[model samples]
Target chain A: MSERSLIASASQTIGPFYAFALTTNTALGVMAQSGAIGERIELVVHVVDGESQSVADAMVELWQADASGKYQHPEDMQARNPDPAFSGFGRLGTNAEGEAAFTTVKPGRVAGPDGGLQAPHINVIVFARGVLLHLYTRIYFAGDPANKLDSVLAQVPEERRSTLLAYPDRKRRELWRFEIRLCGEGETVFFDW
Target chain B: MHSYKRTLPGTQPNRRHDAYRSTLLRNPRQPLIQIPQTLSELTGPLCGDNPIGESDNDLTCHFAEEPLGQRIHLSGRVLDEDGRPVRNTLVEIWQANAAGRYNHPVDQHPAPLDPNFIGSGRAMTDDEGEYRFVTIRPGSYPWGNHYNAWRPAHIHFSLFGPSLLTRLITQMYFPGDPLFDFDPIMQSIPDEDARRRLISRFDLETTVPERALGFKWDIVLRGSGATPFEDAGK
Candidate 1:
């Protein structure tokens, strides 16, 4: 079907709860156009089987600490410098190909829930069916020293910590691709919700 | 029923035989793209505070109602390509209680809660894509964001089609809701006319006038095109 027809058909059944937003470079809007930042970060989140195969059409919600470790959401929790411009919450559905990409500037250092400093990183949550019984998993950036001190990260067994961090990508300059493996043999270690 | 008969788009139907099939198999296509039209152009909130986990102060809606009325009956069908009915598709519905409060733990608002309003239900579409439910008319409640604001009487729907990408979430608003214009979520939709497509039409003949209005809503899911993620390594 044409894109128009597809959207028509899809929109017909979509309930009020589901809101579609672009997680691609478009989410950055003008911030992406600013050339001042060093190497643009390309985050590729693929919902796939345990073996790293793609699981398209999965819904992914990302909530991260802003530069000051504050979420822009109006929840009970508070942020130090909640940038009115930064929502800290991003929602996107994986394309038919099981991959969702976000072109965003790397997040800056923020205070951890405990008062210690947390390394600048993006937090990711992946939702899919095979893993339906469990709705989401957390994915983090690799090599940040804060990973060692972060309370949430420190709680997980060291052997399973790699499941949350993405491999460093040097070829695309600073573009980091985080392939989220939903299920299969090498399933990323998920936390107890 | 004879008075309800409408002519087919193409060949004149043989009124004597196969009239039903002819109507069913008509070229289910409309050349006229009726861009959605609506008299009330109200929109609702798109994104904001996560109301799901908010406090109790803002959670009260549908807290009171005389629990004596018969169950409100709602029935509908799910149609596929070629206008065939798909059976066993899971249908889920949630609405504000009669008092406009959802039976969720996170809601702490001062809205009333109807002990009678279950606020949630589930059913499977039959072979003919037909499904039915028993519920109550959810109440309209106030919100902190708007001045004298109220949400239209509506139900939140979630459908899990035979396929994964076919999953859909939508809302169904009743006709003649005075608060329809003041809702933020309804207004968030990009197009004003397209938004009306979400409202349900009233059927007075079947509805118990003194009781509740019968509304018919038919939802169409995407059936054609390469389902997304087919080419990727699965």
Candidate 2:
């Protein structure tokens, strides 16, 4: 095939009216229900800008493997079985306070690209008005033993890695808290891939 | 070595770019990080067996009535960099009303909003990667981005490609919009040809007789390009 001359369209900001266009009942971020087999957990996220201000109009999406380490995607060619009850995906727009919460089970370890076992993590994508391109990151359980050995986490600078860890909430035992700062100090570790 | 444009410069909000809002908080510089694609990035969220229904593609009937203004039939295809159709992908659109006012709460434009138009719709691409929407042409609206700056008539589009990394959000503009040259947001892109890609062409073939006119636009995801690699040195 010949080299294509048409350049791909440049991206624009999600803008303020994205909620009016994209919101749906299912986008409220409930990946697994009561019948799903796993320890149910809630992920609470706050989207912030460089000045530590809340980004109320941002959209957050979560993708992860099922509790049994199986992804409900066609690309997962492994012989592992998936949890029928788990859809393994969720999306939600930030509220007036720049916060979004997801109800799902903690995912199990998945295979890393380097033939190693990656630590359990939830992949996150952020879209908002000020951001021209969507930001990509991961949420790792703060106390997970495998974090130190995870290939992806190992590549991050030691000091900045903590930004990717989601700590257990002090008041709520079932909830994990993650703060994604789009820029400035304590910015979350964003990925390019 | 293949050199692809990563990020365009002269687009920072603080760069006195009049078309977009100026703010101190925008990311001034972005480092191009090289990381291998993971399963999570390689896989995208599924839109279910039938992401769109017959009526979902029509923005004119959302509020139980036809929206006021000139109706149009906007059609497009979602293709990979290889030019193959990307079927079943979800396509979403939103825009201002015919009077340059959005139905959103934050919009304070003096123009009256059309009660019949909520200004949003969704559709899944067909086997040929084609999708269509029926909606009225949006009007130019004033924004506080700069002095006397009015956004050109345009529609916002969001698409979920085959992989999460390929997800894209862009705006589609009408051909021959007078504000195209003055709009800082449109001029933010450095390449002239790339900027032109954002404008849809008038398509008589897809136009409905005695109904809405047709406009054609196509979106190409990143996979259509050769594998991206980091160049040595700054």
Candidate 3:
């Protein structure tokens, strides 16, 4: 090995042709079935640019705790257990309508570091061509009282906190809609973490 | 205390002048958020013990018959910024067929698609962070990125590190691709050395005589050279 040896390859944007290279039946959605456990919910995520135009090429991934508020990850120090049927992780690519839909159960409240209860929320990671790097954020159910007590939500600016909430659809009982704006006014409150 | 360099530079300014329609450089209202790595960002998703068959790592064997193209042996190791092996991680790759056409629906390129090639494969790193895949050599294809622009032969790679923050998605290019000089996507990386890092080298030892040529490419995940997240405030 010599000095100034090549490091790993530099990343290029996941251009429009990403569908050509990356799309797979399992990569688009991870949940094995809809009959897992807890309250079944349908999450509709619309990714848009600053101009309010849909971003069809973006990839959206979701991570959440199981119905019992336990994560499937090894880092979860708590002794709580994960629901055997729930993988607690999923990935979906935005379609021409800029929507990435996931059929999952509502996650339960998890215990925060300070022994306080954190709000029920789903973590999201967005990757697109122009994004250069992926963006991190969370989706909290709108009108949930837990949002007022969540330590993570408290770190976000009061005015922009609403951007993280998703409202239930009027016609569809279990459907919720959340719009993520990558730039411009009303951009979703992206967290550093 | 360890000091890390901001090795990767920001987006290039010259790219905005390119005629590519999908270029991010032309996005006048892009967000300017400065990302700071936190504990959640630093940790990557842990993979479960999904069962793998012998053919999982071989892209050319999916179809009933062999894929129609020149066979290639691709091997690589996953390393952290400190140059230590990153074991138990997943390495995935996808690419076009030998005709420079994809097995996807949206690819309308005039090139013919090989029915025997689905063009996707995955392999988990061993204890030493090594992964190998046997696949056909992909060809170059034209894109609307610019006038008469064609992409060079390449393979897309996705890696999941120990933590979420280290997840890397990049493309591996062949050495001496003629289109390298004209590809705006490849030129987006500001550093000359970083661009060279994308090219895989010919490894005679790994080559199968009279069967396939071999190429070796190692992927380095974020670590010492990563931009210090704290500097985003300045």
Misplaced by over 4 Å in model 3 are A1-9, A20-23, A26-37, A110-117, B1-20, B23-44, B224-234
Tell me candidate 2's TM-score on chain B: 0.85
Tens digit per residue, CA lDDT, model 3, B15-97? 23244455442233433333433323333366636555678799988768998888999998988766768888878788889
Interface RMSD of 3: 4.9
lDDT of 1 by residue, B1-234 (tens): 000011112211121122112111111111211111110000111132323221111112234644433346566777653344656666667766676666655345477755655466556676788876656667776655445766677776666554322345566787788876766556544455456756777666658666655677776553433334541522
Q: Which stretches of candidate 1 lie over 4 Å from their true place?
A: A1-193, B1-71, B208-212, B226-234
Off by over 4 Å in 2: A1-6, B1-19, B22-24, B28-32, B48-51, B224-234
lDDT of 1 by residue, A73-98 (tens): 32214425455544444556676687
All candidates' TM-scores?
A: 0.42, 0.90, 0.84
Deviation (Å) of B159 in candidate 3: 1.6
Task: Point to the candidate with the largest DockQ.
Answer: 2
Better of 1 and 3 by lDDT: 3
TM-score-better candidate, 2 vs 3 = 2
Q: Give the Cα lDDT of each candidate.
A: 0.49, 0.79, 0.74
**Candidates sorted by DockQ, descending order?**
2, 3, 1
